[model samples]
Target: MLKKLILIALFSCSAHALDSNIIEIMQYLQRDSDLIQRGFFLNKFDIVQEGIEKHKVDFNTLQKFNIDMFLDEKHINYSPIISSFLRNIKENRIALEKFLKDNDKIRAYEAFQQLDYNCMKCHALVRGW
Candidate 1:
């Protein structure tokens, strides 16, 4: 009985950690995304008067980034769909980061478009549309 209760407590703690990680990712996705949209799409200077902030996501906490945070050396032999989804997310993030670094409006908007698509797909799979 004690062992079972301890295991349950450990699992609950892990779940809380996972939820916090997901929330942090969501915050980054929503925050910097708005910055990009305002700066690129609406051409708003007041919002990003100084300059755009770079993304601050730590990919390690993401469950999909299993085996390697760099997402290069280790590979998952999962189904093509899952593997492709992870790749798409990683690629989109890289593109978005590059566009942010360069401060290119057109490219930044395009990268945000692709990022939104991936986000929707991932969200639908994880929760719902």
Candidate 2:
């Protein structure tokens, strides 16, 4: 009976840990999404240079966090939204990278505008953000 109780307690703790990790991952993803959307808007509208500056920090924060580990089988709550959001981020990053590489402010600004619209559409249809 004591052994069974110990096993149950261990299982409970493990489940809780997994839940917390999944929540953290979700929070990180949400943060990145919000930042990217805001940055794109600020850059396109030319109204909030500060927001674009802040987004650089947010991107660095995302880089600091290890997202791949939470994508394992232990976190069974994964969905299409996760993959879709990741892909969107990647595409946005690539657009920005290309803009920077060419030093073409006009193209960069236009890409950001498109990215902003895409993010909004996805949020409205997918996560209801």
Candidate 3:
């Protein structure tokens, strides 16, 4: 009985820690996304680069958590979809980097739009919308 109680306590604490990490990652994502958009609109390469770097770190940190925690009951089995979202995000990030490096604003903007699309799609899926 004592062992079971300790295990239960550990599980609860682990879940709480995962939730906290997810929330912090989402906050970082929002901040970096805003910075990226603002930089693109203002034609500030430095800001965009900074945002992209930070966003990359955020994604890496996010991958360390159990993604199912982000989903509602209706979408609990949608881990594959969430994984695809991550792939799309990675593709867009690479494209954005290449375009920005080449000084191609138009292509960078398009990649950014795709990145935004993936983010919204993932959010909708998780929220069961």
Best by lDDT: 3
lDDT of 1 by residue, 1-129 (tens): 999999999999886676676677667656765775676656774444222333334333454433222222223232355456656866776786677668775776676688668767755654424
Candidate 2 similarity to native, TM-score = 0.43
lDDT of each: 0.58, 0.57, 0.90
Q: What lDDT tens digits, residue by residue, belong to model 3 across residues 1-129?
A: 999999999999988888888888999998999999999889888999999999999988988877877676778889998999999998999999999889889999999999989999998978768
lDDT of 1 at 35: 72
Please list the residue runs of candidate 1 whose C-alpha ends up more than 4 Å from where it truly belongs after superposition: 42-83, 96-104
* Alpha-carbon shift of residue 22 in model 3 (angstroms): 0.8
Residue 60's lDDT within candidate 2 is: 54
Those runs of model 3 whose alpha carbons end farther than 4 Å from true positions after fitting are: 69-73
lDDT of 2 by residue, 1-129 (tens): 999999999989987776686566546645654664565556543323443445555545554544544455643344356556546755765686578558776676666666566556644544435
User: For model 1, what is the C-alpha lDDT against the true structure?
Assistant: 0.58
